[model samples]
Target chain A: MKKVFVLVLISIFFLSVLSSLMGGVVNIPLKVVLEVFTGKVTGIERTIVIDVRVPRIILATLVGIALSLTGAILQSLFLNPLAEPYITGVSSGAAFGATLAFFFYLPAFPYLPLFSFLGSFLTLIMVYLMAKRNGKVNSYVLLLAGVALSAFFGALVSVLMVKSGRDLHALVFWLLGSFSGRGWSEVKLAIPLIPLLFIPMRYFRELNLFLQGEERAFELGVETEKVKKLLFFLSSLLTAIAVSVSGIIGFVGLIVPHISRLLFGPDHRRVLLASLLLGPSLMLSSDLLARVVFSPSEMPVGVVTSFFGAPFFIYLLIRRKN
Target chain B: MIKVHDVWFSYEEASVFEGLSIEIEKGEFLGVVGPNGSGKSTLLKLVSGSLKPQRGSVLLEGHEVSFLSRKEVAQRIAVVPQEYHLEFDFTVEEVVEMGRYVRGGKGEHILEELNLMPLARRSFLTLSGGEKQRVVLAQALAQEPSILLLDEPASHLDISYQLELFDLLSRLNRDGLTLICVLHDLNLALSYCKRLILLSEGSIFAAGRAEEVLTPENLGHVYGVSAELHSHFGKPFLTFFSPFEKVNEGLQIHIICGGGSGSLLIHELYHRGCRVSLGAVNTLDSDEVIGRKLSLPMAVEAPFSPISDETHKRNLELIDRAKIVILAPLPVGPGNFKNLLALEKAVYLGKEVWVVNPDFKGRDFTGRVGEIISRIKEKARFFSSEEEVLKELENWAS
Candidate 1:
């Protein structure tokens, strides 16, 4: 049964990759796409496939894998089903930092994500410290602190948006989230950080140990405090990088891990692997839909994901209740 | 082997354990019992390395528990906590296999040993409470620790399952696994645990073999109740009674009993503050022993001796000093046939006479005693048990 699920995910992943490469405003045909890849095409089609489509698809896949893996880790780290990168305020914190760069007129595209990384890593620490009691993190307190901090950082983002007299359009577009005009330069920075996801993957058994709660996990020989700090650091790093590249895409992180766990069991090894594969597929499909839905103009991929992912998440909650 | 040396553990501002010390030998099944807030569960946590003491150490095989590496501590001690929530949909097998994190294996041997083979593939969320507890126990045992600690393992289970779980613990102890359990039920602790420790107000109130540790005086003083400890087939048992609220003054009851039929009545009457006197009991009778234990005055005779005129005169004098007289069910043999005559004399003296389990009809060896009891039966109040007698006493006192 697990093999069949893996086979189907692989097929869907390849299909979405193929479709996302060809399905865009320029509408390159499959034949043209194949030729461009095979080095048989040139001119505008070659430029479109190589320069525009390749980086965009690569960025979408990278962000997908990053966000979904972070989402899975967050859920296990907090031992909460509703835990995600956005819900924990890492996305809002990163976005706030990027807005700081834009409002100050710092070099926008090249050095922005460094500030974003600092913003999110610091926010994770703040939330973690606020939630700790008697040497253990209370998950409910952590959730509430995440919300209050998210709102505080969101208000800062708004303040920056109002201060940016001429850059408001860019700030709002980034806040709403998009993948437009991103190139190989941004993908190059992200590729180096992608391997850090393996750190969390190696602790899959420890993550499973946490499902029985902190004390039980400790009794079972897990260094719970160290594991928690390591996961928090790794997941925050992944989320900051993804947010810097994709401008805070929503719901992909929240929904894809859940769908993976629902398809596979709650064993973290299978769930984490499935989420890594499913993340790219969902992100590519959402990006494809965002590009083609409006024809001449594209909707923000974040908007598209929220539009579909919210109701699906609600449906899952209702089904889980019954 | 485990030794807790001068352990001092506190939570927030409240101290739970203050310089408490205990030592447990290898292969000894020990039970820790206490009232709520006495830190029974905390002691287990300290021993299992889930909690560290503030001022002392828990040593397992001469190594401090909190100082050892987590895997090292886990390899020596495993705990079955009070309860756990099942939030994920892992199978029973998956849950049990998690105990093999340090030393990985299939965990099939533990699953079969715990009789969880049939439920191995079932979702953990789909199990009943007993089954869930057993699954959790299986998970802990999968660690294969030398010492097992359980905190209130039978608290939420029904009686049958409670017995079954304790029975399983006994079997595990017999197999040479050192067991330490916190139990709320004193009877189960007394029957199953080889050694018992009773804790009160965060310190050990009593500790030793169950019989010595669960003495009536210790239980009554700690729990604010009147209690007795008895043994059945060499296993200790405990019985509890209501403590006296206030002494009902100016009331007295004299009981004529033998053959162990009046011990319970004597205890109930004494606890209710009735001045009780037992009469015409032969020496070495079980009832005489109970009467002496409660310090009630009794009219006694030699063993196997019939009630003499002097003993009868003393019994009548005791009945004369009482407002109510009780006749406990006794065989009317020729040896003590005068005891019934004493009851008739008490009724003839216009005292209120009560007959408990009145069966003087065929209990007669003298043959004429039935007619005498029937003549006095109209004036006597018949009661079934001590509970009914206590109720009547309450009514009369009020």
Candidate 2:
């Protein structure tokens, strides 16, 4: 049953990737897209399929993998079902950092991701420090601090938007989260973070033990404090990289793992593997909807994701109560 | 083997243990018992290497536990916590497999050993309290540790499940596992653990065999209650009584009871602060159990034997000292016909003689026992129940 589910998820992911490449503005035919891949087509069709859609798809896939893996790790680390990547203020901090970069007229290539990484990492450190009582981190305090710091950084980003003159439009689009106009450079930025995903995969057993509780995990031979610190760092880094490249895509990080767990079970080994596939499939489908639903004028992919994610999340909450 | 040597530990300003030391032998079934806040759980944590003592060492197999890596410690010891709350819906087999984290294996044998194979696929969150605890125990056992530590694992279980759990633990201990369990139920502790460590206010008050460590005086001093230790089926059993405020203090009440009829009346009178005594209760009788537990001055005779003249004389002496003598609704048999004779003597002494439920319709085993009851009817006050007798006593005292 698990293998069938995995196979189905992989197929849906491939279908979503192919459809995303073919269903964008100026809707290229599948034959043309395939021919472009085979080097038999050229000019605008080739550029549209290769230069524009391919990197966007790859960036979307990487961001999807990063966010979903982050959500899965955070949920287990905090022992909270509702934990997600941005639950630690990483997305808002990255947005504030990107807004600062744009406000200062810094180039978008490397400086944006670097500043975003710094912002998210600093926010994580601050939350960790605030939540530490004695030498141990209290997950409840960490959650509260993350939420409070997220709102604070969000307010700072809004303030930066209000003061900016020429960057207002760019800030708004980035804040709403879109993968439009991104190419290989952003994919290049996210490729380094793929290793971060594998680090958490190695700790699947530790993550499984964490669902019982921290004390139980420790008694069961996990170096709980060290594992928590390492996983927290990796998840924050993944969130920062994903947010920096694609802006704040909502619910992919929050819902992908949940969907995977609902399809599979709660064992992190299968959940992480399922999330790796489902995250990209959901992102690609949501991005495809964002493009074709509005035609030449695209809706922000974040908006499209939220459109589906909010109701699905509400359904999950209601079902869990029973 | 584990040795906690002079462990000085505290949580913030509240010190839990001070200069506490205990050594447990291999293959020993030891129970850690105490009142709340006596550091039973803390001792388990220290030995498990989850908590380090400030000024002492917890040595496992002659190695300092705090210095060992978590995997090394877990390889030797497995701890079953009080409660396990899972946020995710992991199945029982997955949970038990987590026990093999330090030492990797399938742990299928552990599942079969714990009888969890039937529920292996069930979600842990959907299990009952007893089932969840059993799964946790299976998880701990999957580590294949030589020593097992439990923190009141059966506190949340039903009475039957509690016994089932301890029976399983005892079986495991008999299989050469060193079991150190912290138990809130003293009876459960006494029944299973051959040795006991009694803690009071974070210190070891007593430690030895169950009989030596769980004495009535030790239990009374630690729990602030009057306790009695009795042996049943060669196991120590404890009964406790809260020290009641003196209501009828200095009032002597003699109860002429046999069979199990006088147990409740004796308990009520004793708890009400009356100086209660018993008369001519046969050994091993149900009433005799209560009388012996309370340590009340009483006259006793061999079971099913006729009340001897010496025991009847002793019963008369007890009745003579009492300000009030009450006849319990005990059946009159030929073996205990002397009890009716003692009640007549109480009437003659001018003491307040009360007969509780004098209707002995089917209870008269001796044909002539009812005739003696008629002789004392003029002087004896009749009440329907023990409650009525106690109310009348309260009224008479005022």
Candidate 3:
């Protein structure tokens, strides 16, 4: 069953990758898209596929994988099925930092991601302190604190957007989350940070034991506090880098991991690989929907994902209740 | 092997154990039995390294448990906790495989060893309580530790499952894995553990072989109940009772019985605070055992001997002093035929006589029994069982 699901995901991933490159305002023919792969196409077609659509497709796929893997890791780390990458308030914190950078006209190329990462890292620390009682981190309290901080930071972002006069379009697009006009630079910014996932993947067995309950995991020789800390750093870093580029893409992190778990199994090793595949496919398809549904005026990819992802999540909840 | 030295442990404001010390040998199956709040579960946690004592150390294999690394400690000891509640779904195989996290495998052999092979693919949440316990036990065993700790593993199990689980543990103990189990059931502890430690007031009140430690005195004082320890097929079985209340309602009764007929009546009357006595029973008879157990005053004689002249005189005297006399159904034997004659003396004294099973005609040893029967029938009330006799006695008092 797992093998069949993997095969199907691999095929859908390739199809979504191909479809994302061919669709958009400028429709590149399938023949030219295939020819570009063979290095035979040049001129405007080459510019459209290589310079424009290719990097955008790769960025969407990368963001999807990063976010979905973050969700899977966070869910297990928190021992909560409802946990997601953005639930830690990293998305809001990063959005505020990016908006601040845009408002002050701070050098957009390098300072934007750095400020975003700093904002998320500080919020993580604050959430950590708020959730902890004495010396132990309480999972439920952490969740509540994350939500409260996210709302506070989201209000700050909105106030900054409202106060700014010139960068209104830029701020709203960043907040809505999109891969529009993204080229190799945006992909380059996220690719180097993708290896942050290696830190969490190495502790798959420890993460598996964590699902057994924290005290039981500790009894089984898992350094639970240290593992949780390291995972928080890595997952927050991954989500921060993704949001620094594409803003706050909703539900990909929340829904893709769940879909992968349902299709595969709850074992972290398998779920990690399956969600990695499924996340990109879901994101690229949503990006495709964002491109063609409005045609000339494109919808933000975040809006397109939320449009479908919210209902799918609700369906999952109702099915589970039964 | 484990040793707890001068362990002073407290939970919040209450002190559970203070200056408590114990030593356990390798390959020994030890049972910790105690009343509630006696620190039995606390002792298990201390040895498992999950709890650090406020003022002492727990040593496993000559090394302090707290000083050891997590992997090092876990490799030596495995704990089967009191409950297993996982919100996420994992198969039985997956749960058992968690034990091998430090090491690595699917833990297939451990599942097979515990007879969980057929259910390996089933969802863990779908299993029954006993099956879940077995899965947890299998997971702990997969750790391959030298020492195993269980906290009331059978407390939630039904009787058949409890026995089956203990039987499995006994087999494991025989295979030379040291076990320290906290058992709520004293009889289970007595039957399974090679040695027992009885705890009270956060200290070891008694510790030794099961038979020596589970004495009636130890149980009665620690648990605040009267009890007796009897041997059953080379094992100790405990019988418990409420403390003896001295009731002086000032009612007196005498019983005439043999062949184990009046044992229940004597025990009931003794517990109900009636001044009761028995007459002319041979020593070591089954009814005499009940009388001795309850410490009742009775006229006794040698076994296999006819009711002697002296015993008959004592029986009549007992009948003369009683307000009511009960004659339990007895076979007409030459040895005890004189017991029936005491009824005539009871009637003469104007005492109420109750004959149980009056229609049992097999006991008419005396040739002149008809005259005595008709005369006594007019004065004596007939009862079919001992319960009816006690009911009549209760009515007379009320």
Candidate 4:
């Protein structure tokens, strides 16, 4: 209950902050923007606030939530303190997919989502197959294999981009990650897996048993491979959805769960729950700041997140050591 | 109940056990002791269902163990391995709680009985080896298993904990838990075990009550040591005596025994292995136990025993195989005078004769050693060291 309150409280806070910043008298005057927000104002003001900023903020929040949950699950899966959602070849594979899409001279490059989705899925399978020796899967082997394949796929992605001749700027932007193209369409695409992802998130105690080792868990009557497969399928689907909409957002999925763990402990129950709630709140607020900072010269939401998240991640690491 | 029938196990090229069969009844505290690579640990693994036997099967409580799912097996039997390298820093409470993993629930009583309640919240990895061992035992007990398989569980424990652990196990057994333990300590086995099984070269060499099975002869043959089996308050124990040594002024054994094979038999007669002076050969000869191992001063001839010390003293020491006489046809002759006198001394002492080998075709003696052999022949019945040797020589036939 207290956790929910904290999440709700942060959500309302970011919502108000975003609304006030986008139109409040500093930009379009408080009364006008307030009126627009309340359906009292007429014409362009209503269109701008409701259609533009609201959808983007919601998208940012949902993406953030996805990234954080994925990060938390990945960490415990490998029993590695350094593992993150992106570490499993998701981002790089998605980028490779997007780069391939850009090369085809296809009418709608937005179809890049399909390419990145496939790339991510392929990388995930490669990692699983490489790590599963006989019937056993070792964490170090999985991590190393994921890292190597992700790098190799990333190089292939870069080569594809270089061969294509249609203004590299657009392809580069998509590869780096940004929330500009996301609206209700992308938002709708990402939310369906929220329920699927929540299934594993609810079973953190089982995940804890798994961390003890499969042999022990199996002795305890846990169907360990099933649990791992479920986690893989759910986390990958959610990651693919997030990457599909937003080019290849790094650091959010990598760092959010770490912060979640620092606050909520290693128990996936609390960490995943907190992640689901806090992610959107943090990502939404960052998008709001990205929009209003140095007005008229829009900054990519990805740049804003890195500037904020990277320093905070380092601080958490050092502070955790202390 | 544990039944291993015709089970075969090996590590790579070396076969530890093949077609071996044994049955252990419920609540039986069975002690399994063996030489290295003799299938002691392998037997435990097979019974625990931790390893699959290449041939035949293991039945527990009249059910096939290998076919049971891991959970079902874990619920039935608890296995405590020798090494405990727990990576997670779980508290004692948490560690013990894992034992109930098979129950898919919890058992608070098992942890408390192991005296782990006080250390419940203490980190498991931080504890000393003894403490960790207790915690591990607590975890296994937490399973509340009907049968327990412990493999060298006391290897890391100090003497105090070793005894304490065994006491706890005995108490558990008294409460009707069946235990099968593989132990290297013979005395500990004799003291605590209701039955003892001695394994040699991956086969059951001896098994019965400690008093019945752990005889001096059995120890000498199975463990290759001429040991003295001791008993205290009706509980049998084993302590070795070194071979006869002139240094002690006891029966000086001019062992006609050859080969490094007999070293352990001679060693058990001494301290550690045994305490006995050696004789009847050059210092370099392998059969001279103390002469080769302990640098004991022996009446050894240069190179081979000369007619005086070599053949003669050898014949004299042959008298030591028996205070009576042991006619080992080491071809006695004129040069082996002292050996002949030694045999005469055995006859005079009225000691019995033990013929170690009956296969050698030597109606012979040349040196003093050979002379001693011929003299002892009438008194000792020549027999090989097989089951038949004791049967043929139980009463001094000569």
Candidate 5:
């Protein structure tokens, strides 16, 4: 039964990829999209399919995978159900970093992603230091520190937004998060970091043991302190990269892992695999709606996700209570 | 196989262990027992290598435990914690398989051995406390460790489950697995563990065979309660007196009881600090067993034999020394007819005589013995229950 469910998820992911490639402002058909893939088509259709839409799709998919996988690892690491990439303060710090980039009138290409990665990485280190007590990281303290630093960075971003005159519109758009105008460069930046996901995946058994608690995991042969340090660094790196490429996309990291757990159980291997497939499916489908719903003008994909993800998460919580 | 050498450990301001040392032999079932805060659990943690001592060392097979990696330690030692709560739904098999993290193997044989195969697919969070404990045990056992450490594994279980779990542990110990268990329940410690380490105020108060280590003096000193160790089914069982009871020191009370009738009244009066002695009871009688366990001054006779002149003289001497004598609602038997005669002697001697729950409607086994009871009842004050008798005794004391 689980195999069948996984197969269905894979099929839906492929369908979402194909539909996302085809459904846009020009409304390219499936046959033309296939022809473009096979090099039978050229000109505007080819540019739209390969150069325009494909990179955005890949970038969105990579961001989705990074966020959801990081969320899965964090939830198990902290042994908390509500843990996600956003809770770690990385997204807000990245947004603050990007806001600074726009405020300084820096070029968008390498500077924005670099500045955001630096901001998120520095914020992660700050939270890590704040949460450390007597040479050990307390997860509860880590979560609280994350919340406090996130609000601090978020306030700084707001301050920058109020100060910048010409960059205000760009700052707000970036803060709201979107996949527009992103191309192969962002895709190239994120794909190399994909292998980092395997670090947490390698300790899938230890991740399962962590759900019992840190002391229990240690007793069960997991080098808990070492594993915790490695996972925290890896997840923070993944979140920082994802936020750098796509500006603070909400709920994909928080909700996709939960959705996967609701479908496949809490075993990290299955949950991780499910998140790998479902993250892209959700992101692609949401991005598709973001582009096609309003036609030439588009709603930020973050708004679409939060607008739907929040209610769906609440529904899941209510059902679980029963 | 395991030795803790003069270890010092503290959690913040409170020191849990101060230069405490003990050794556990291979194939021995050793119980670590003490009151709360006595550092029994801390000792287990130190032995399991989860908590490092500030001074000295914990050695497993002559190698320092802290020097070994977690996988190396876990490959030889498995711990069943006091309690485990899983928020996420993981099946029993999956939880058990987590034990194989250090040493890779399927836990199918362990699940079958624990009789958890039927519920192997069930979510661990949904099981009962006993079932969860069993699953946790199976998970620990799946490590295939030579030594198993359990911290109050039966604390949450009901009576039957507690027995069942201990029985299983005993069977495992018999199979050549060295077991070190931390337990607060002294009776359970006595019954299951062959050797015991009794901790008191961060030090070893006593350590040896369970019967020798779990003495009344040691228990009273450490726990501040009066404890009596009795043999139940040829195993030592401990019964404790609550320290909160009012003290009535120097008040002498003699109880004439046989069968199992006087056990509770003796415990109650003794707990109230009365100097209690027993009237003649036959050997192997339930009341005699309790009297012997409590070390109360008592007269005894052969089982099912009539009370002899010598034993009756002893019973009368006990009655003479008492300010008050209580006749428990024991059945009137031919062998103990002389006890009624002693009660008459107490009444004649102007000692305060009380008959508790004097319902002789169906208790009379000898037809002639009821007449003597009736005669004694007229001279004795009759109370329906032990509570009323104790209340009246308190009034007399004041």
Candidate 6:
């Protein structure tokens, strides 16, 4: 009951903040913005508000949902608080493909999403191969090797960035992570998997067992090794798709799930459900602020999320110590 | 029946056990005793199918244990291991419920029986050690197994919990459940076990009734202890008597025993670095416990008992095994009095032969002290302190 009420409050607050940002420098009144939203108002107000900001808002929300869900699943699968989609190297691997597509003068590959998906999939397979030991992949060792592998590919992506250097503006914006270029195609690419990943992961009890230690789970006949492999493949799929179009959004894949755990308990079901609602809403509002905070010159969506997530994360670490 | 036949175990190249064999009948309680790291836990692991022996086999209900699946073995036998670690904060009920995991039934009944239902809502980390151990037991019991293997189940628990655990096992045994428990507490083993298997260095030293297997000879040989064996309540009671602190500096310890008691006195003094000598200890005598360790050149009697007068002369040669001649609590008979008479010479030489008593007169040579003070002084040398004697000998060493 309390969780539902808190969700509604957060929705109203973020919705109001997003609308005010959508309204122009002259600061259109709430009624006028509603009028524009409802198509009663005319000219540039409707075009700028409904056509431009509304689509961007929806894209930010979708990307945020994708990233947070992936983060939640990855953390549970690895059984470590620090495991995130980026930590597994999938996001950076996708970024390397996008940069390579630009390097070859194939800016419009007509399949940036497919190329990114392939790169991320390859990276997941490689990591799984490296971490597999005694027919089981231990999460601690896997994460260490994954971080090392991710850094190696991250340096490779930086090299591609230097080689492709042209179309500096678009490449830089994509690297910084933005919803500026998102359209129905990107949204259509990510939408089908949301419920696919979301609904299954929301089951609490089985997930609780999976995240607990392996021997205890085994003694209870849980088939721990199988569960880890299944969850790892599923999370990598979710993260690869999300990063395909968003480029490399940072903190949503890292900080948001941890923040949700601090607010909710460590139950993955509640943490995930909270992320579905809170993740998008927070990102949408942050993206809006990023878009208009300095007027016409837009900041990356990653910048806005990190600007809020980083300090709060530090505060969480300090507060938890006491 | 569980049959462990001619099993050998090794780690890499170092062999732990060679040709070790024992049999446990259904509904029987077997207590296994051995020195530390004597492959006792390894034996349990082999029986539980957690580890496979390199040679030979463990036959559970006449089936090769390694051939069965782990779940299949778990269904037959439940083991409560020594050190337990489980991740996450599960309630005691939830933890105990894991035992019933094979049952595929709801865990409420197990939690209730394990006395964990009341603490069901609390996280598992809040429980104390004994509580945690009970939950582990509860989990194993939930399997409803016919055979149970416990590796030091009562080691971490307090004395009351230890008694409670044995009582529970005894009750389970009454209900026709077979239990094999490894224990360090010999008293607990004596009190509860129907048959005890004394293991020395990965081999069975003795395996049978508590009375026959737990004699002073066995204690001396297997455990390197100088012990007294007496009947208590129709059961054998073995107690350690320290040869360390002399009852008086006058009484010398010259125990005419067999098996390995020689090791005990030597260790007691060697650990204290106290000097010792030995006599009339036949090669096969239990006094070998000290003889092997200290390299004491004992005036040995021949392997067979019923000491002859010539052996008595050889035994008297050790009248100087120590300053005072001490006799351990051994079942004395007429044939061994020559060894006792040799001790009388030590007494004549002003060295005292002190006997530990529940009536030292039954061996029959008792007419020296005519006055009350002299008789009192003669009996005053009887000792019970295993520690003080060792401590004094240790001081002698330094």
lDDT of each: 0.85, 0.87, 0.83, 0.66, 0.86, 0.67
Off by over 4 Å in 3: A36-47, A87-90, A93-149, A163-169, A315-322, B87-89, B115-131, B156-161, B241-281, B290-294, B304-398
Number of the top-ranking candidate, with TM-score as the measure: 1
Per-candidate DockQ versus the true complex? 0.76, 0.77, 0.56, 0.26, 0.78, 0.20
User: For residues A74-161, could you state the per-residue lDDT of candidate 4 as single tens digits?
Assistant: 6666554445556567667767776676678654334655666677767777776777664455656866876787789778877776
> What's the TM for model 1?
0.92
> Which stretches of candidate 2 lie above 4 Å from their native place?
A105-111, A125-147, A320-322, B126-129, B158-164, B258-263, B278-321, B331-350, B362-369, B372-379, B387-398
| Order of quality (lDDT) | 2, 5, 1, 3, 6, 4
| Candidate scoring better on lDDT of 1 and 6 | 1
lDDT (tens digit, per residue) of candidate 6 on B244-302: 44323323345444444334554454433334566666666667645754576566666
Give me the displacement of residue A20 in model 4, in angstroms. Answer: 11
* Candidate that would win on lDDT: 2
Model 1 spans with C-alpha error above 4 angstroms: A107-111, A125-144, A315-322, B158-171, B242-244, B247-250, B329-337, B357-370, B377-379, B383-386
Instruction: TM-score for candidate 3, please give it.
Output: 0.84
Candidate 2 interface RMSD after superposing interface residues: 0.7
lDDT of 6 at B350: 71
Root-mean-square deviation of every model? 2.8, 3.3, 4.4, 12.6, 3.6, 8.1
Alpha-carbon lDDT of model 6: 0.67
The sequence of per-residue lDDT tens digits that candidate 1 reaches over residues B1-398 is: 79999999998879998999999999989999987888899889989988899998889899988778899988878889898776899999999999887668858999998899999999999999999999889888988988999999998899999989988888988999999999888898888899999999889999999888888898887888888887778766889897886455557889999998788887877877888999989989988988888888889999989999999888889999999999887777887888888999999999999988766666667887768768987998888776787777777773
lDDT of 4 by residue, B214-307 (tens): 7777877776655656556876678865443223234333344433433543553333222334434444556563456555434465555444
lDDT (Cα, tens digit) per residue for candidate 3, span B221-307: 899876678788976898777765444255788999888888777766776678888987999998887788777778888988999
State the lDDT at B25 in candidate 1. 96
Query: What would the per-residue lDDT of candidate 3 be over residues A1-322, giving only the tens digit for each residue?
Result: 7788999999999999999889988888899899998999888989989988889988888889888988888777666665665666777887778878877989866777877877877777787677667444576687688789889988998888788777677668768889887898888887766677566568778878888777789778777778888887777777878888899887788788787778867888888888778989999999988889999888888898778877876675577567
Index of the highest-DockQ prediction: 5
